[model samples]
Target: MTRRTLHAIRHVGFEDLGSFETPLRTAGYQIEYIDAAERDLGQLEPLAADLLVILGGPIGVYDHDSYPLVADELQLLRARLAADRPTLGICLGAQLMAAALGARVYPGPAKEIGWSTLDLAPSAKSQPLAALRDVAVLHWHGDTFDLPQGCTLLASTPLCRHQAFARGPNLLGLQFHPEVRGDRFEHWLLGHASELATSGLNPVTLRHDAKRYARTLEQAGTVMLNDWLAKLKH
Candidate 1:
């Protein structure tokens, strides 16, 4: 039997693959990462993957002038969606996915910087994201996406309407950080302390709640990861 391949695109130095790496490794998928900040994405193709996970980053999707790789990465994502392969985009990755699909990505009402509850859309009750009904996920984004044509809006919060969306059977974009765990969250909080001040959120408060939310978030991530894998099997 052939092992599945998972292409993981990393956008920054600190944003490494977190909890999602475990299940993919356990399931015998070959995980390969391309660092978008340092590497040229034009030479990198999104093909040969049973799954593709575009991880989160500190940069905005529209900041292509500073991060020139953004355009090529978006183009690659567009091609992947056209091929109809299994793809998951988290946070900034989700915004890029939305932009590639012809949906506008712009600043949201306010930066959602900590744990917040997301209400599942009525239609999501029958889909893989149904597990998210009234659940709180780690949110750290300031940008949100408009629902792309033909895609189902799965989850939302007061701050962002397009919290999560699914395109057909195998594509998902989540604006929140479902893949973050204790250590990873700590790293992010410590690394991006300056941004917390800009967003009017206290990093100390986020750290205080990190320990409290870790276990629950991990459990929720497991459920979501299992659901994503199940969808890929079809």
Candidate 2:
């Protein structure tokens, strides 16, 4: 089988594709990392890859004036999404996708950190997220977005209403960190130590939850990603 290109827009080093990497390779994708900070997104073709995944980050969507890379990503996403190419966005990535799709993205009422189970929409039971039924995923984002027009709401939590949304089979946006790996989870705690401390969230508690829930999310996340991949419209 021919290998397809998978371009992942990574904002930070540790926020790389974690559990999704192995499955993507097994499915014949040659992965390429486009570091949003280091790479010139202007030089990169928006729709060049078979798949584009926008990874999670600490940046907010409205911070484009401060972080010019946000503008580049929005421009890139608008082009790719206009063509309806296969795209996946996680956390801040999801917020970016929503902004690109003409939806409002802003800070939520409260920071949703730690592990929590999602309330999947009834329709989501038949969608790719079905594998995540009752599975607790890591929720590390503080920002939320409005449900984009013409997108189906997939999952939600009490804190955020638009936890996950999909536009047909080609586009998906997840507001949580289902892609986080258990072994490398320390990176998250240390990397966002300031944010955690500011929120009065102890790393010890998050570490304990990771031990309990990360493995389950890893398995369920793999299944969800593979299921979504199998159904992609080429």
For this target, which candidate reaches the highest lDDT against the unseen true structure?
2
If scored against the real structure, what TM-score would every candidate get? 0.94, 0.99
User: Which tens-of-lDDT digit does each residue in 1-234 have in candidate 2?
Assistant: 768999999999999999999999999999999998999987789999999999999999999999999999999999999999999999999999999999999889999999999999997988999999999999998889999998999999999999999999999999999999999999999999999999999999999999999999999999999999998986
RMSD to truth, every model:
1.5, 0.6
Local accuracy by lDDT, each model: 0.82, 0.95
109 Cα displacement, candidate 1 (Å): 1.3
Steric clash pairs (candidate 1): none
